[model samples]
Target: MSGPTGILLLDKPQGPTSHDLVGRTRRTLATRKVGHAGTLDPMATGLMILGVGSSTRLLTYLVGLDKEYTATIRLGQSTTTDDAEGEVVTEHDASGVTDAAIAAEVATLTGEIAQVPSTFSAIKVDGRRAYDRARAGEVVELKPRTVTVSAFEVIASRSSGTLLDLDVRVAVSSGTYVRALARDLGAALGVAGHLTALRRTRIGPFDISDAADPEGDLATALIPPAEIAGGLFPTATMDAEAALALAQGKRIPVAVTDAPTVAAIGPDGRLIGLISVRDGVSRVLTNFPNSEEPA
Candidate 1:
């Protein structure tokens, strides 16, 4: 049945990469129009929003939203990848690490700070992935970037030999890396560290409960296009004249009440186009479905 299209929230499993999940969803839905909002590491299991059909247009708004994750950081050994999948390069006594120390480090990590992503990250360097360079024994020195760690709380801690396992929950802005947080936190305390577990709990307004099972029907899990458009801003119904003009990508003199982004709906409540307030005039950022049929 043809209808309004949008994104599906899936609770991605641990074994498959984000791209693998997209491939599986495409095969299941029998459509090549599927794409993901963001990439999740293979070791991470949690909410992944998959865009389908014309709904892929929504990613520009969705991907920039903040995300929340729960993770376990192991302080004692440094890893090549800064995660459990990497080989341990060094180990030391972590018994000296106290919960209070970890708390202080968390405080330091919170708020706006500079972060260096793991070398085994998807960040591109010289037209090659950082991880590829790292695996090839190449030293990848990446510049630190600004990322806001809104919250960084240590929930639990345990000590085993030289290992100090810390469970933490963090809410951060887009591009913030928990793996990097673990690495930096350990170094801040003069101990090497690596991430052992990670699970994303939320992405903006979307949460784990809103996600479907990894093997569930992703096509059916998609939120109705109207709901997707509705989440951005107050809706504005377009007349036949405005609709036709928008379908042609032509600018109109109509005023948008929203401050930043505004969704324009047609007479039937069908999402036609996305318009933004530029200075004072409403300019088109993008149009979903067909510019002719809906936009």
Candidate 2:
């Protein structure tokens, strides 16, 4: 029998890199096809989606979805990495900064924005990872890219010891950099800032609550890959003949609907894979084969 193919929503704990969890998941599921939709830093935790077995095909859709995060930004100190991972390069007394000023700064960061990702980021420069080059004592200046911060709002603000801490909730495009928001906000406010804590609350249709421990039960934690695939795309139910044909790479016809992407569900209501209609013809972007585990 094939191992069940599906998405595993991993509530990644702090301290381990994303790759660490992927390795652990491979062992837990006893499969070598484990992969993640998005990469989270070791210090950050929550809502990381993993693909198992044949479900790896779903990653193409998952990676492009919007993401949401909640973070505690500590004003008055900025690090060389623009996050807690780097050394403190600048500090100031942010106690005097008022709530109104913080609100104004956040307002400026909302909507479509051009942000320079953290220097200590995963961006590839000259075909090498930016963080690698940076750690080698090379100055890496990355070009600013446009990313959408659909919503950027300060949820709460309070005094933490001698510093002002702001808790923020952000809904952004897939590649939006929350660390950059914290860094730029501090710079705009004349007080240094760095992300003290961050948790991914949502990634597309999957919530943090859906995630399970990577080291935990494989059977219970396994999310059917079809669930993740259908959740992100428009759903369509297909008859047995159509399902078999699609599984065999035959095109199916789709009726009118406003959905841009459609999930083709079989007669049993199980997802057959995702399909899109163009000029009344269905095109299969992915055909999920019955998943089985390796010996």
Candidate 3:
């Protein structure tokens, strides 16, 4: 809590679990108070949002943001993990699968649909992870959840003897799994499918192009919490008295309607906290500890 506080957009390399990235970030920034907004499989590379120091409080707001990914879906073999890392369970001659058919199935997968996650996912079940249960040779039956897939476009395609590979870009809501989409698409086409590669390109407004390499200069890569809040929510300027009242757990007479939460900026231009307006009054939803500290 005493170190630099800000958000870090990290472009994670493959082969490291999301938790591993956090550990490396903690070491790179020399702060143990690092946290991430979302998780990525060890086999997948992409943009990972990390919050350092007091900015860890901002991760909850970022968790629900939409995500964008570019991936390769193999259309011939289905795997235990719904990815290349998993053992192959089934194979088929995908050479006969037509591009028109692939397009049609992809169209169906787009928009809102119910999808079952892969058995090797990190979803918790009865106080244990589904992947943990799966690794123990137990059958994991995850319930289907509704998720939105705004876009699922096949950017390129390659067909080899008995297999077909598709390079695609997908934009989806939070909690939507790209592996599930690959599995469902393969199943719909009569050939089992699994993700061969995946790279997250964006999360909400944050792009992978702006992300920093965790092994590089991470201390200077931190984005101030105030700047992050300004980009994420509606802004409202609060006078000294109002800022003090909110800090003291008192509701202030600030009316806001543009958003459910407003980024409250103090008179000195420092971020006070996030506040919610209701019935013509605003109350602090989250208060920063050192609001008066100079940026």
Which structure among the candidates has the greatest lDDT?
A: 3
Backbone collisions counted per model: 0, 6, 0
lDDT of 1 by residue, 1-295 (tens): 4433667889988989999998988887777878888988999999999888788888888998999999999999899999999999988888898878888888999999999999999999989999999999999999899999999988989888878999999999999999999999988888889999999999998899889986976556777666777886766678988877887888776665645677878777777878876555567878876531211
Q: What is the lDDT of residue 97 in candidate 3?
A: 92
lDDT of each: 0.84, 0.85, 0.90
Candidate RMSDs in order: 2.5, 2.1, 1.6
Worst 10 residues of 1 by lDDT: 286-295
- Which of the numbered candidates is closest to the native, going by highest TM-score? 3
Which residue runs of candidate 2 sit more than 4 Å off their true CA positions? 160-162, 256-260, 291-295
The residue-by-residue lDDT of candidate 2 on 1-295, one tens digit each, is 6775677888989899999999988887777888889999999999998888887888888898999999999999999888888999998999999989998998899999899999889999999998999999999999999999999888989996658999999999988888899999999999989998999989987899877877778667777655666667777788889899888888767764735578887777666877777877788778877444322
Better of 1 and 3 by TM-score: 3
Can you list the residue pairs that collide in candidate 2?
2-292, 2-293, 3-292, 3-293, 6-225, 234-263
Sorted by lDDT (best first), the order is 3, 2, 1
Candidate 2 local lDDT, residue 111: 91
| Per-model TM against the reference | 0.93, 0.94, 0.96
